[model samples]
Every structure is written in C-alpha cells, then in structure tokens.
Target: MTNNKNQNLLLRSEHVWKVFGDGNEKKTILKDMSMSVHEGEFVAILGPSGSGKSTFLRVLSGLIPPTEGHVYMHEKELQGINNEVSIVFQNFALYPWLTVRKNVALGLLHSTISEEEKEKRITDAIHAIGLKGFDDAFPREISGGMKQRVGFARALVVQPTILMMDEPFSALDVLTAENLRHELLTLWLEKKIPTKTIIMVTHNIDEAVSMADKVCILSSNPGEIRVELEGLPVETRMQKGSDHTELVDSIYQIMTNPKKNPQTILHDGNHIPITLEESPYQVLPQIGISKLKAYIKKLMLQGGKESIRELNTNISLDDLLPLIEMMDILGLGGVEENRLFLTELGDAYAHGNTEEEKQILKKQLIANVSLIQFIMQQLEDGKHTIHTSDVLKHLHAYFPHQDAIIQLKTALTMGIYAGLFSYNRQTGRISLIEN
Candidate 1:
C-alpha cells in the first residue's frame, strides 16, 4: 500500500450531483458527493448494485458531466472526456476480430505518437500483462482471465495517470479473480504502470478490503458517500479472523442498518429536508423462496436467532446478508447488534406446510412490498390490468435501468407464486387475480 502521508491530491469531486431525467420524473443518482483521491492511493468505491457506482466513475472520468458541481483532475476542472484517465470495464470490451496486439494498440490510435512507438508500447503492455506469446490470439481464443488481462493491457497502453476499474474482475471465476487481483497488486507495488492512482467500483466487500488503501462506502437511492475508512494495512487483509474481518463486518452493518440516518441533499443551494418516507427503499434479497425458507428454518432451529458470525461459519456472508435483509423486509426477521432473529411471521413460515408458507408469503407481499401493493391498488382503480412499462417507469425512479428490470421481475415472480397477481409474458401486462 502507498503511504498516504505527504501525498498530493490527484483527483477531487466538489458537491457533485448526477441526476437522470428531467422535471417531476428526474431522479438523482449522486447527491452532494464530495471526495478526493491522493497520489499513489488505491481507492475502492463500495456499494450495493444500483447504487450508481458506475455513474460516479463515469462522472469522475469525465465521460458524463454531473448535473451540478464539479470534478477536478490534478486541480483542473475536467470537461468532456479526460484523456489522462482510462477505464477497464466489467465486461472485457474486446473486439472479436482484433488480436491481443491490435486491441492494445488501439489505445494509441488517437495519439500523436509514431507507429513504431505505438508498436513498442503495445508490445510492452501485452508482455507486462503476461500475454506476450498470445499477442496474436483473438478474444474468443482466450480464457476469461486472459481476456481481462488484455483489457488491462489496453488500458495500460494509454499510459493513464488514473486507472478506473468498473468491476474489472467481476466476470471471472473466483480463483481467476483472486489471481488477477494479486497480479494487479504486484503491478501497482512494482510501479510497472504509469497509473498514479487507481479508483475501483465493486460490490464485493472482501475484494474492496483486500485491495483498497481507502474504502468509500456509498449509500443507495441517490448514492452518497456515507463512510470512508482509510489506512487499512494490506497485511491485515490477508489474515483470516483479523481486525480486517471486523472492519468488513462493520461495513456490512453500516449498509444494512435500518435506522441509519438518511442522506441529506442540496436543493437550489439550500439543504433540503429528507423525510423518513423519502428514504431509500430497502433492497429485496435476490435469493429464491426455497433459500429464504431454509435459512429461516435454520434460524428457528438455532433458538430463533444467531450471531451473524456463527451463521457465516455455515454460509458465506455474501449469501447470508441478503437473506437476512429479505427476512427483515418481509417482516420475517431482522438484525439487531450482530445477531439475526426471526420474527413471529418468520417462525411461522419456518414451521408451516408448503401451502401455508405460500399463504404467509402472499400476505406479506400484499402488506409489505410497495410494488405489489401499487399493482393491487392500480387494479382497484378501475383497471384490472397494468402495463409492465408503467411499473418499470415507477421502479426506474428508484433504481438503475438494469436493477429496475430485476426488481420488477423479482416482485412479479413472488406475486405470481403467492397468487397475488398473474402476469402475461406475451403481453407484458400484469393483472390482479380475483379473490
């Protein structure tokens, strides 16, 4: 890790706000977000999906302009595309027809450099990323990890002062991701690249802890930088059961705490009051119904509650946190302190037969889930059917495009399973099932 003390500011954001849409339908993605990165620092931006991580990155990289405020690179206001910054995408954005050498050389196409110099830089980048012999290989001929290396090579060929990674290794298998992470660290430590700072956007908690010199946690529903932890030693991250684990757990708590203060916003240069009702909606767990049932049953068998750490011993935190949050959303359970406890509804569902479980879920869907209730209300408002586009528009106000689709699909699935509504896949319409 780089020494933070005496480092100069490399980049900064001043009260930046990114708002999509306009007028009444406008949705703010980033609000009054101010943060800075120092030279030689590896900063990880951690947030849940749909938290505008990628949007923030694009704003910082000058690919998109913020609706309000400013982003500065090296103390100068950034306008339009930033040539000093390069991004590695989640998907290896490599062309199928381009070989490794040609792909990497593409970065130099717009440069004033000579062809010979471009070839040298391309060769050096390809070799530096461990793709020397595979320079002639097409993207389809390479493994996922190797393809990502080509991404790194392409980005490096630009000789960027800042490297922006948007979940660069997320598409790889676990082992491959780990290996690439270590390789990246080795490159950073060895000063093999010209990158003065690295800013990564990731949803994986462990990956952030392991690689970041500083971790900035973003809160969703108008993503804001809620927490920033710095000076985390890389050595501590390598050890299991270390203080780093506790730090990771603390981040999880910060993200999951229901009563945590809502993020404040600036409206027309005045601090706008945020009502509790306007607070970010709780994210529904992405797990299936069976997984939710099994986990609730396990909690019940374990005296109706268990410490998250204990539960994690059997199931990974990646899998456990969502289920716990789902239980909380469904009024089935919640986390207090470090423990997870099942509510009366959760306990009943655990012991109930399949039919009874469905009944309980249906009741919860109608009572707890706002989307389902909205659909039900729409049906009651003289309309038996609602277009999926209408629901999607409603959801897009809260979530990103992809996440809005996921949330809508998930809600529709649950509603269908619970017999609350029937969706016509062919017509893209949803209708309430008559009682």
Candidate 2:
C-alpha cells in the first residue's frame, strides 16, 4: 500500500459503517470496512446487489459521510463533499433541455475561473471524450452511447484529481459498452485525462478483472471487504486465454458461496482465505418456481452434480447465484467444493409428481424459512389475511430500501408455490392458505 509516486494518499476508509433509517427498520449497510487507494490506480469496488458497492463509492468520494467511521482524502479526514473527485453516474445525468456543450459546462458553473478558461476546458473535454462534433446535440438527439460520452465529458471537464464511475457502461448496448471501455481505458492508462486516480463500482466480475489495477470485493448483510486482489494483466484479460477464464471461474465461486467463510482465489500469485461474515437474514432471490424446477432437472441431467461454472454457461451470475442459494436454503440442493448437487429431498422432489413436489416444498418452507412462518403466525394472531405492506415493514428491516418490495414479491412467489400462502395481486393481501 506504499505510495511510490510521491503524490498524496488519494483515498482511504477508516473502519467505515453506514446505516440507513432508524428503529427496527434501520439496516446496517456497511461494517468496520477499511480500504485505501493510491495515486495512479484504477480501483473497482465489486459486489452483488445490496452489498453497498455504490454507497461505499459515495463515501470514498465524500458525497456522504459514514455513520460511524471516517473517509480520508490526501491523508486528511474528509468532512463533506470532496471537491477533488468527479462522479460519472450510471444513468447519463444530462439536462434534457441543454445541449451537450451546455451540459459539460455545468461542471464548472460555480467556479471562479474566467469564461475563457471554462470554454477551453469544455472544448478539451468534449474532444477528449470524442464529442467534438456533437456539442450542439441535445440528449434526445443522441444515441445511448453518445449520451454516456457526454457524461464522461461532463466529469472530465472538472479536471478533478479522482474520477469515480458507477457502472458507467451498464446502460449501453454491448458493442457500444465495449467501445466506451476501450476509450475510457485509453483516457486512464494513456493519461489523456488529467485525473490522477479512478474509482469505479461494478457488479460484473470480468469488468473488474479487465479494467481495474485493484479490485476490492464487498460481501453483503452489512457489507465488508471480503477480499482485495490486484487485477490481471491486460493481455490476460482479453478473455481469450485459460488464465482469464480460470480466474473468472474462481471469482464466481467466491461470490456465490458468501454464506460460508469461502476460501477464495490467488492474490498477486499467493493463495488467500478471506473469512467473510455470514448473511443470516439472506434475502430471497427474485425469481419464480419454474426456474427452480428447470435447474433441478438440469442438475439431474448432469448425473445429480456439476461444476456450477459449467452449469452457468448461458445464465447470468446474478440469476444463478440466487437460484443456487435458494436451493441451499430449502434443503433441496447445495454447493460443495464448487459443484452444485441435489440433496436427497431435492432428488425425491425432482422425481416426484406435481402434487408431491408441492408437498416437499411445503415441508421445507415450514421447517427452514422463518419469513414464511412469520406470515402464518400473523394470519393466526389476528386475521386470515394480512396486507402486504405490513409484512414489507418487517422485510425492510433486513433488506435494502430499494429491494424490500422485491423480497416480499419473491417471498410470496415461493410461499404461494408451496401452498403455504395465497396472495391477492389486485388487493395486495396475503392470506394463510394452510396453518
């Protein structure tokens, strides 16, 4: 962590903690997290949904303060918004009424610099981000790729010491995203932009591996630094070699196995075991029963067990991880040594008829899932039906604010599928079907 560039200590988190809301609904988003960035580095914060990757990035840039800890920039504790950092948002945050040049100029709106200096910086930024001819183009007049270029231009026009991006390419088309990444890397690696450091937050493991000098992964249920590793070489990250493939495969294992203290991959050629905290109140994956059945059948087709990485060839990591974790929770199946397999109950359910499948799921849900049990108790305590909002209040205490509603939807998906609860979609009521 030495800074050999003879520059300032760019950024660091000191036992950072972030909590949202208060009372029972208050959820701790980060816990005792400590990390640092040096000058001349592109660091990526990598994690799943609700892992506080975006929140951590905001704290690092001094957009928000940690509830209980500290964020430091240039070796001094930061109190408010750090003027040295610029954020390239996930959504292109251009003013709809403004032309590209006008939007880029907004970056310097409050500066005391002369209009002459402002115009030069604006022109330079637009040209550097490949938006020279599009200065007069309004946001609606440009394509998604061009709009993001305008975003980069706006951030660059500030000429800040640190540039932070939050999933900058996630909103673009595949080819356009690829082109933008190449352009952005040129700006960073070739020093085309005046920024001394870059910090980005992303959920894509390959994106982190390919773009960053350092990649720090955060684990969920009160996000903490799970592991930090130096990124792979550019040639190795071209996604054409065995090294790239193997490293990506290893990362997939580490991410999907979060409930355990997963012994993860190599760091700078040395193997390390990062003991991560377990997520006890793990949120349900936003998926349906049909996908679960199909995956179970797929597992059986593979002779009851297969490498999860191989099984995930056509599926996204976001979808696959939740599905596997759901199976593990239900006693239907689990992962062992990086392989996914059906438990005895799962095998029986896989072979069972439709009625038998529901019965097995009912038994598992009743025994293992507390959320389902809570719903049944609620119905028994007062009435046969409960408003979804009432249960959502309980859910919000455990999950992120944005994901609380999703947790309810997913809970009901499994609950209704197992015949434990009946949901009224129009009325937003959940009734106990069995108790």
Candidate 3:
C-alpha cells in the first residue's frame, strides 16, 4: 500500500558483498552493491539466472547476514531477520499438515500481539486474499493457485511494514499467474493492505515492468546492478501502448546483450545500457548438447529460418535465454537482430539422424569451448581416467561449490553427446574415448 506522505527512506544497503566458501575457493555472489527502498514503492530486483537475485533478496531482508557491509532500516544498522518485513516464496512453502488458518498463524508466532488480535488478523487476511472458505483446508487439498493465495495471506497477516516476494508466481501456470499479478497490484494500488513498501525478485521482464514502481536491472555472474528505471506513469502501466512495447523491447535488448550502448541504439539517445566487466569464469548454461540438438531439430522442423518471437513462444524468458545464448556461445546458432540463423554445421546436424551430428558437435566443442580443451588435456595427462569429483574440485577455482558441480554436469553431458568422453554415473568416473 502506497502513502504519498510516507515518502521517507525505509531501507537501504551499503557496499554489500555476499560471498560463499573461503580461501582459494571463495566466490562472490554480490559485489559492492548498494541500493535503497523508500516508503510507498514497489521495487523489483530483475536479473538472469545465477545473477543471485535470491541471495541478494535474502541479504536485503536480513534473513542471512552479508559477508561485508551493512543494511540499514531508517539509517540504523539492521541485524538478523528484519522484523518489519515478510516474505512469500516462489514455492508455496506451506506445511501440508497445517490447516490454512493455522498456517497463517505462523506469521504471528513471534509477535507479542494478543491471541484475539491474531485471530482477527488471520480472518481478515484469509478473506482479503480470497481464501475465506479454505480456512479449514490442508495444503494438499487446494489447487496450486489457492496454495499460493495462502502463502500471500500468511505474509500479509503479520501486518508488515515491508512486504517482499521471491518469484511468487513462478510456480503457477500462465493464466493463474496473470490473474494473481493483477490481484496483488489491485490490492497495493487500492491500499487494501497495510504494507508500506513491496520488494520482489524476478527474472521476468514483463512482470517487473508491469508491477514495479522502480526497476533495478541486475547483471549476471557477480550480480551487479546494471541500471535503475523509473518515472513511468501509473496509467501507462499494463497498457498495450507504444511506450509499454518500446520499454519491453529496450529492456529485452539490455538483458540479452548487456554491453551495447543504450543511447546509440535506435537513435533515441535516452537509455541506460548495462556495462559490467564480465568475469572470466565459464558459466556452462545447464542446457547440454542433447537439448541443444533437440532445439536445432525443432528449428529445422519449423523452417530454415524462424523469427525470435516464434522461437520464444511457450517458453519463459529465463529458460529460453540460456538455451539460445548457449547455442550462440557454442557457434551452433546465430541471432542477428530479431531473426534466428542456424549455422551450416547446425543445419547438417539437424538433417542427420546418425552419428554424423555427434562428429560435427565434437569438432565444434573442441574448436570453441576452452573448458572442453582443458578437460581433454586433463584426461590425457591423467592416463585417460579421472574421478568426476576431482574435476568438480578443480572447477571450484572458477565457481562456487554448488555452481561448479552444475558446470561439471553440463560439461559432462556435452562431452558424452559429442562422443569425446565416457562417464560412468554409477562409479562417478570419467574416461577418455580415444579413436
């Protein structure tokens, strides 16, 4: 709920750095980041996958302490679980055994408010969130949408000064998510809830643009703030106007290719382009060679050429971006402006159903990916054998432990599909496949 007179600064972060691991394996998730949230504003932290949007939100909310720097509420240092805030998670995160009314009570578990007030709050919250009749229902009995409604009620029942959501609608289907987005915005704009401010983390461009009063775009891999956008008229929001379309396009461009100068594009001279110095770590996007081949086959099925919009159909931006980006990175796919182009090798692979595709992909990986080259050399040096854990530990020099494990998994998938390596999942070992 917005209050024009309550325009005072509510919360802010200063030089915050969130690092995981220690010593030589240390990886910084957020680097020297600082931002502010004022009263009566909906702020969206938007970024790509592995940009640490969730990590940053946890740090901002004081759910976890930052490794360096401070978060201040009203200019005072915040310590351990910001009491004024409440969060709704991406997953419903409800207790299956608890009834809706009882589940909502968890928000008041630490509050000193009397039992009568707590009951009234629960009743009001359940009604306001459109789950009035579901008070006695268990989470297992409700629809996915209703489960999420209960999530919102629990967060709001606390009467928080600041409300935060981490991809709250991500788990819902398209129609349900759209409906919830509208409902929440109505509640905030109509002042139905007591929350003075709202902060959300999302990878969706349209969701951020439609919902947020201020949009802070974040760059991946160290998750730096790329730009802060504001001043869109409230009336212009959610409207299918030129302004809305243009804003979405510009944001899409920035998200897709962060290095391009925003001011020079389309001769507008009125945009803020992202300009982060990309790190050297190889972020092997989780889409492996088999999936890549499937996409290529799909593209060939459509036609030799498909518009970007056509390819993006039925897929969310977060999932689709990594896949197309990986293809471009591996020199198998090309996107120039709005059109998608398949490489000659990619075309041939699409046409062939046999080992010809694997042979072509092997040559492509060896020529393009340095990580593949490094892994191949290690296999040769280790007498054509190595433990997957050993390679994972070696990768920790580049990524955090969890991320390094995922990188190894993606690389292994690519190596297997390319016929360049053999991996025994049962034994957790990798061996070279010399011709």
How far is 213's C-alpha from truth in model 2 (Å)?
Answer: 1.4
lDDT, candidates in the order shown: 0.82, 0.82, 0.81
Residue by residue across 195-298, what tens digits does model 3's lDDT show? 99999999877888888888888876678887777635566776658887667666666665545555444355444545556545456666756667777888
Q: What total of clashing residue pairs does each candidate reach?
A: 0, 0, 0
Error of 3 at 102 (Å): 3.9
* Residue pairs in collision within model 3: none
Q: How many clashes would you count in candidate 1?
A: 0
Worst 10 residues of 3 by lDDT: 262-271
TM-scores of all candidate predictions against the true structure: 0.75, 0.81, 0.80
Query: Which residue ranges in model 3 land beyond 4 Å of their true spot?
Result: 1-7, 21-27, 48-50, 95-99, 113-120, 132-142, 219-222, 258-274, 278-281, 307-309, 315-319, 352-359, 374-397, 401-435
